[model samples]
Structures are given as structure tokens and as C-alpha cells.
Target: MKIVTKRDRVSLRRRVDQGTEEQRAIVQSILDDVKANGDKAVLAYTEKFDAVQLEDYKVTKEEMEDAFASVDGEFVEILEEAAANIRSFHQKQSSQSWFDTSEDGTVLGQKITPLEAAGVYVPGGTAAYPSSVFMNVIPAQVAGVERVVMVTPPGKDGKVPDGVLLAAHILGVADVYKVGGAQAIAALAYGTETVPAVDKITGPGNVFVALAKREVFGDVDIDMIAGPSEIAVLADDTAKAHEVAADLLSQAEHDARSSSVLVTTSQALAENVQTEVEDQLKSLPREDIARRSVEDYGMIIVCDTWEEAIETVNEIAPEHLEVITADPIQELGKIKHAGAIFLGPYSSEPVGDYFAGPNHVLPTNGTARFSSPLNVDDFVKKSSVISYSAQALQKNVDKIARFARLEGLEAHARAVETRKERWK
Candidate 1:
């Protein structure tokens, strides 16, 4: 494991702080090819990378039917249950377009409108994620998106993952295609002959997929430029060392570069957790990945006070923060940054990742300072409403016109003044 003393540290930020330049070039190349060649380029990359041939890039109704039948009935029930939880949690975010009329006959309100279509990209390499389908699609559903489309790479055997297909069906996603990587994002951002365009895309993916999202931001909305998974556990001596170690390894198992950290005031607790991490690492199925992740990005910061522990957490701004100290709630109030806060021992990172009813496609790599977790707001747009009676118009029109003129936008000023005759 890598150890850094507080004094000798060159930078306090964690190992996942910045992006490597190599992935940037590949992403740029993919963006250019997709923009230039459209559907043809995307399909070609799909064939070469995924080793699958496609007569057409769009998913057919027959394929979806087969996907539903392939899965077990019990699993389907679970999917329904998970979807319900996700929907219920996100429903609180739902908003309406309303109008308020004043005595002066002025009507003003705000309009909440869903995007025409939202594209979700589920990772297709080495794993299948039905849970991700819930996290990404349910928010768009709650926001009343007209359509939620999905893109994922097919297996070498020319089939997409059953979990992905089943989740798509459960979430009412009509569109699915056999594509992945930067090319998939391009196809979604700018509609090709084969793939329909989308207004936004959301999900956790590899570096290539993340870079693709970053490049396509203006062309279409993206959730966040996600990085390797990370977690920081703020524990006191009262916390179980084994539980802390297990939670740390959970994130480390994600990728070789994923970060797992323990910030605590108890030196004895830190030592015990380190021992537990080694003992438990032997039994893990993905021990190699977890080991490398811990070696590369893991750390144990021993601080003197709980305040110091939280200060370190703010400095890191981890993607996930688990407050497992004596007073987890008090620590939560102190934490102003972090994409998601997992309170208490039971609220580990995996709970949020799997079934906690919160979206796991969180901001990473210090982006917690400015970004937020994926939610209904990501799929919806808000519009401000403004209406004024003659009396109200007369009261504010001059101020509006003058403000526009002050900004040298005469056209905007004239646009407001155009209605001046009625008020006069």
C-alpha cells in the first residue's frame, strides 16, 4: 500500500484526481470519425471492437421479446420491486408547469418540461448491469421523458446482456442498439441514419465512454464525466474494523485505479482496519483488481480530531462518503462536498450502487465540489414564465428596457418596449 505523511505530501488530492492524456486522443479521434462518417463509422467501430457484425444497428422487437423470456420469473419480480423503489424516490423531484394570476392581471409561473428523448449508456464490457438501468432510466421516467433510449455493446456471441434487456423492458425503454465505446456516444449525440439522436445520456462507463460523454456535452447533455469509483469512510474507534475494511474493498473491486480510503481519529482503529483489509482480500473473487486499486489509490489518514477527519474528506471530495463515526448525522452536516453520503455502517457504498433507491452514477475525481448525483433534474428542463398587466408592465418595462440597453442589446430592449403602447 502507498503511504503518505501529511507533511511530505506534494498534493493532498487522491490518485484519481486527473485524467490521463492518452484516453483524450482516442476520444477525440472517435468523436471526429462519428461526426464525419455518422452511422457507417459507428457500425465499423462496433464490428472491429466488439467482434460482432450487424445487419442493422437498431434493436428489434423480436430480440426484446426473447430477452424477456430468457430471464427467470423471480428475477423479473425483483426488477419490478427495484424499479418501484427508484421511481418512488425520484417522484419527489417531479415538478409542474403552473400559472399564477395577480389582481393586476399579470400571469407568471415556471414550466417544467421533460426532454424529448434521453439516451442511457450501460457498460457492456465484462459485466451486465440491470441495476444501472434502474438508476439511469427511472429518473427520466419520473421526469416524464417522452422516450428513453439505450445503447450497449453486444457480446461476441451477438447478444446483449439479459439483465440489460430485462431492465430496459421493465423501465419501458423502447430503443436498444448493439454498440459501445465512444462511437456509441457519437451515434447517440448526432443521429445517424441508423441511430436516432438523443437529448441527454447518463450512466457509468469506462474511460473511453466517459471521454466520449465529455466531448459530446454541447451536442447533447451528459450526466457527468465519471472516473474510477472511489469511497472515503470516516470512522471512529467505535466502528468495526472488519466492516470498514469490507466497505473499502467494495469500491476497490471496481477498477485497478479505483480509490478506497479510511479517515479516522483513532490510530488503533486504522491499524486494525488495515489488518482486516489484508485478511479479507484473500477471499474476494476479484482480489487482483482490488489489490491493485488499494495499492494505487488507497490510504489511511490518521487525524487527531473529528474535525480534522471531515476536513480531509472535503479536501478529497470523494465520489462516495460513508460517515460511520459515533455521530454520523453530525458529520453529515459538516460535509458540504461529496456526490453521495452513506450514513452509518449499514449505508455502505454498495447499498447506493445496488438497491438504495439513489442513483449511483455519481460525480467522481474531485468533481463533487461542483457536480451532483444523477437524478430527475438531469432529464428535465425548466423555463421561467413572465406575464404582466398594463399596470405591472408600466412598472417594470422601463427597468427592463434600460437594463437591456445597458448591456448594448438594443434589440432585446426594443422587444420589451414593443408592448409599451398598450401600457401607455
Candidate 2:
């Protein structure tokens, strides 16, 4: 990990927004092809990029049953428990339609409507992330969306992972597809012959997938333009160096661009953590990827005071923040920006990633400054409900006309004026 003082903050911010124009162009081409050719283009790209060819792109019922039987009974029980926790947490986020009525005959309210359909993208290749299946699906289901579609890349043999398939079956997601990358995103945005168009798309993906989502934002609602995984640890002299090092590396191992940072009041603890991270990285299986991440993006910023450390954390607005101080709870109040916060030594970031009810899909980079995590609200739209009775319209007629005409909107003014005339 690179050790530095708080003065390097400006340069670090620039480094986080780095981009590649060539990658964007490639993703655009794939998106264009999918939009024009539909399922034919999707299959061609799947064969070209994933090295798998397929006639039919949808997962069959037999495949879902096979996935269930392949996994052990113990694993199924654990996933069911996790699903229950996720569902319960999201259910609390569900809201009801409300109306406010007045004796004067004005009815003002909000009506919440779940999206008609939603598409979830799951990255599939060598590794399988069944947890993602649970995290993305349950919230949409809780929001009362009717059709939840899933799209994942197929392996060399052209089959989705057992765990991914099992997770879908457990959630009762019937519409699963065998295509991925930019093509899948395009298919979801605009209807393909096989994959139906969706109102929204949510999940983390590679750079190509991110670019595809960015290109199709207006065509369909999306969660966020996700960046690399990142975690920031705020600690003081009282915090243990080994635990701090472990937490930093947990995010670093995700990818070479993933950022892991430590801001501390004590120079001694910073030095100890730097050494501990190096020691731990030597044994990790993804050492090459983690090492590059640590060398390039990992940082340990030593500050002169707790106030300075907290200020630095807010500037970064990291995706995940962990506070390991003598009073972690007290430190949380001082933090104003972060996607998800893990307080104290026992409340590590992984707790929120897996078992905890909070959604794992969060704003990345510095987007936590303005955005939020994926929840039930992401799957629903709210409409304002307003009805004016004759008495109400008669009372407010002149004011409505004056306001609308003042803005040069004669049509708007006439609509209210005509109703008011009938009332009078």
C-alpha cells in the first residue's frame, strides 16, 4: 500500500475517474448491433466473446431443476435463510398509496406503482456469484414487479452456473437468459426476439457492461453507472493493525482498479497497517490482482487529528467506509458521506455484503455524495394524484389562471379557466 499524508487528496480524485475511449467505442458497436439485429446479433456476440453458440437463449425448466438438485441440502437451507432476511428488510422499504382530503373538496395524494418488468444482469464466467442473484431479485419482487428477468453469460459448454440457476429458482425468477455482456444489456433496454424489454436494469458488471448501461440509460431506467469496488477504513491508534489490513485487502482483491484506503490519526498505526497488508497479500490467492490494486490505488493517509481524517473521508465519499475507533458509534455521527458504513471491529464490510439485510448494490466511486443503494424504491414509480371538486376549482380559478398566463402558457390557463367557468 502507498503511504502518504493528506496533501495528496486532489491527485487521488483525478485518478479515480480515469477512463478508456476505445472500450466505450467497442461497447457502443455491440449495443448498435443488438438494437438492429435482435436475437441474431446477441447470439453472434455470445459466440464471438463467450466462445459459446446457442440456438435458444432461454434457460429451460429442466435446467432449473437440475441446478436445485446439484447443490447440497445444507447450502439450500442457508440460501433460504438469506433470502428471508433480504425479503424482510426490503418489505420494510415498501410504501403505500396515500391520499389527503380536505373539507374544501381538494384531493391530493401519491400512488405507487411497481414497474411492469425488470432485468437483472449477473456476471458469469469462471466464478459464480449466487449472492448477487438474491441481492438484485428480492427487492424487485418486494416492490410487486410482475416479471423479473435475469441474464447471465454462459460457460464454454453454454450453461449457466448451478449456483446462479439455483438462486434464481429459489427466488421464483422464471425468465432467465443465456446471453451476457453488452448484448444482454442492449436486449434488456430494447426488446430482442428472445429477451423482452424491461423498465429497469440493476446489477454490477465489467467495464463493457457498465458502458452499455450508460449508453442505454434513457431507453430504460438503470440503477447507477457503477465503478470499481472500493473501501475506506477510518481508524485511530486504538484500532488493531491486522484487522485493518484484512479489511482493506478484502476490497483490493476484487479487481486491479479497486481502491482500498486507510485514514488514521496515528502515524505508528499507519506504518503498522502498511506492513500488515503486505504480509497478508503474500498468501492471498488473488495476490497478483490484489498486489496491483494495492500498489496503484491502495492508500494510507496519516492525518494530524481525528478531524482531519474525517474530513478526508468525506472528500473521497468512498463506496464502503469502516470506522474502527475507541468509540466507533460516536465516530459515525461525524461522517456525512458513504454508501454503506461498517462500525466497530466486529461490523466488517463483508457483513453488509452477505448476510446483513442492507442492499449490496451501492453507489461507487465518489457517487455516494449524491446517489444511494438499490432498494424497493428503485423498482417502483410514484404518480401525484390530484382532483379538484367544483367548489375547490371555483375558489382557486383566478389564481390558477393568473399563474399559468404569467408564464406564457395560455393552454394551461385555459384548461383550468374552462373548468372554473362550469363550476361558477
Candidate 3:
């Protein structure tokens, strides 16, 4: 990690990855093919990219049972507990349909409706993310979405990982499909024989998946285009060096582009953390990847004052923020932006990543400034409901007409006028 004595020299903003033209063209071609050919194109791409050919892309009930049986009982218990926690937290975020009526009998309200169906794309290949399964599906389920379809690439044996399958099984999400990449996204955006088109798609993927989400955004809703994982720790002299260093590397091992930064008021602590990060990096199993991430994007900045440290954190607006000060909660009000704020030493980032109730799918890069972490709201749609009684329409008809005509919308003006005349 690079150590900087001056806060002015620190810059943690990473350039967002918008796919290359070639990648974009490829994604468009795949989308076009999937739209036209449906499951045929999906299978072809699955075989080409994943090196597995399958007669059916959908996972069978037997497969689910087998996956559940294959995993040990203890781990399954853990997943169930985590799912319960996630469900409990997100249930609080669910909204109800509400209405209000006035003396004139104008009924106005907001109707909250969960999406008819939602697609969750879980990444597969070298690793399996059962955590992704829980984080993505449980919220949609809590929001009352009926159909939650899951898609992940098949392994060389043409089977979904047991852990991923078990997680979905625990959540009662049976519509698991053996597909992935941009083609999987296309299938979700546009319905196929095996996979149903969804109202919204939520999950993280590679460059191609990101570009596909960007391309198919209007056709179907999607979660934010997530960037690489990032963590910014706001620590002071009271923070332990080893614990802070370990938390930083947890994100660093995610990808070479992942960033780990520390902003602290104590220069001596900064130097100690710099040494701790180096010593800790040597032992990480993914040492090469973590080292590259720390060397390229990680930083340790020594700020002159606590205000400067807080200001620096807001500037970064990291995906995850850990405040490990003497009194971590006391600094909460000063934090203006962060996808997920982890307070104190025990409240590590991974705690929220797996077992904690908060959704792990957070806004990445500098988007935390304007965006938010994934929650129940992402799986539902809000429609404004308006019912104007005869008396109310009569009172506001002329004003409504004038306002519409002011914008040069003659049709809109006449539409309201016609309604008023009919009521009269």
C-alpha cells in the first residue's frame, strides 16, 4: 500500500469501466441472437462460453434435492439463519399501498406493486457465491414478487454448484437455470422457452454482463451497473493496525482493480498500518491478486485533522466504509456518503457481506454519492394513483388545461377538458 503524509496528494477515484466497442458489439449480437432464436441461442452460447452442452437448461427438482443433500447439515443451517436475517431486515423495507381522500372526494395514493417476476444472475465458474443467491433473491421475495428466476453458468459437468443450489433451495426459489454471461442477461431481458422474461434483473457480473445491463436497461429494469469492490476505512490512533489491515485485504482479494484505502489522523498509526498491510498480504491465499490491488489502488493517508479525514472519506464515497475510531458511532453524523457503513472493529465488512441482514449488493465506485445499496425497493414498482371526483375536476379543470397548454401539449389540454365536459 502506498503511504502518503499529505491528504492533498490522495486520490481514490477509479475510472468506471464502460465496455469497449468490440465488447459492446458482441453483447448486442448476443442479445439480438437470443431475442430471435430464444433457447437455441442460449444453449449455443452456454456451450461456447461455458464449454458445456445440455439438453435442458433448467435445473430439475431432483437436482435441487441432490444439491441440498450434498451439502453438510451445519452449513445448510448457517445459510438458513442468514436467509432469515436477510428476510427480517428487508421485510421492514417493504411498503404498503396507501390512499387519501379529501372533502371534494379526490382520491390520491401511491400503489406499491412488486414486480411480476425478477431475474437474479449469479456468477459461476471458478467460484460459487451462495451469498449472492441469498442477497439477491430474499429481498425480491420479501417484496412479494411471485416469480424469482435464477441463472448461473454450469460447471464442466454441466451442474450448478451445490452451495449455490442449496442457497436457492433454502429460499424456495426453484427456477434455477444453468446459464450465465451476457447471453443469460439477454434471456432474462427477453423471454425464452426455458427462462421467463423478468420485470427487473439484479446481480453483479463481468464487463460483458455490465454492458448488457446497460444496453437492455430500458427494455427491462436492472440494478445499478456495479463497479469493482472498494473499501475506505476512517480510523484514528485508537484503531488496531492488524484488524484494519485484514479488513482492507478482504476487499482487495476480490479483484485486481479493487481499492483499499485508509484515512487516519495519526501519522504513527498510518505507518504501522502500512507495515501491517504488507505483512498480512504475504499470508493471503490470493496474495498475488491482493498484492496487485493494494499496490495499484490502495492507499494510506495521514490527515492533519479529523475533519480532513472525514472529508476525504466523503470524497471517496466507497462501496464500504469502516469507521474504527475511539468512538466510531460518534462520527456517524459526519459521514455524508457510503454504500454500507461498518462501525467499530468488530463490525467488519464481511459481517455485512454474509450473515448481516443488510443487502451486500451495494453501489460501487463513486456512485455511492448518488446511489444506494440494493434493498426491497429495487424489486417493486410504484404507480401514482389519482381519482378526481366530479366536483374536484370541475374546480381544477381550467387550471389543468391551462398548465398543459402552457407546455404546448394541446392534446393533453383537450383530454382534461373533455373529461370535465363529460362530467358536467
Q: Top model by lDDT, which number?
A: 3
Give the 10-residue window scoring lowest on summed lDDT in candidate 1.
9-18
Instruction: Work out the TM-score per prediction.
Output: 0.92, 0.96, 0.97
Off by over 4 Å in 2: 8-10, 13-21
Question: How well does candidate 2 match the true structure in TM-score terms?
Answer: 0.96
How far does residue 64 in candidate 2 sit from its true spot (Å)?
Answer: 1.5
lDDT of 2 by residue, 109-138 (tens): 999999999999998865798889999999
Off by over 4 Å in 1: 2-26, 408-424
Judged by whole-model lDDT over C-alpha atoms, candidate 1 comes out at 0.85
lDDT of 3 by residue, 1-424 (tens): 8788553564665656898889999999999999999999999999999999999999999999999999999999999999999999999998999999999999999999999999999988668999999999999999999999999989999999999999999999989999999999999999999899999999999898999999999999999899999999999989999999999999999988999999998888888899999999888999999999999999998888888889889988999999998899999999999999999989999999999899999998889999988999998889999998988988998999999999999999998888755764
Score residue 290 of candidate 3 by CA lDDT: 95
Query: Can you rank all candidates by lDDT, best first?
Result: 3, 2, 1
How many pairs of residues collide in model 1?
0
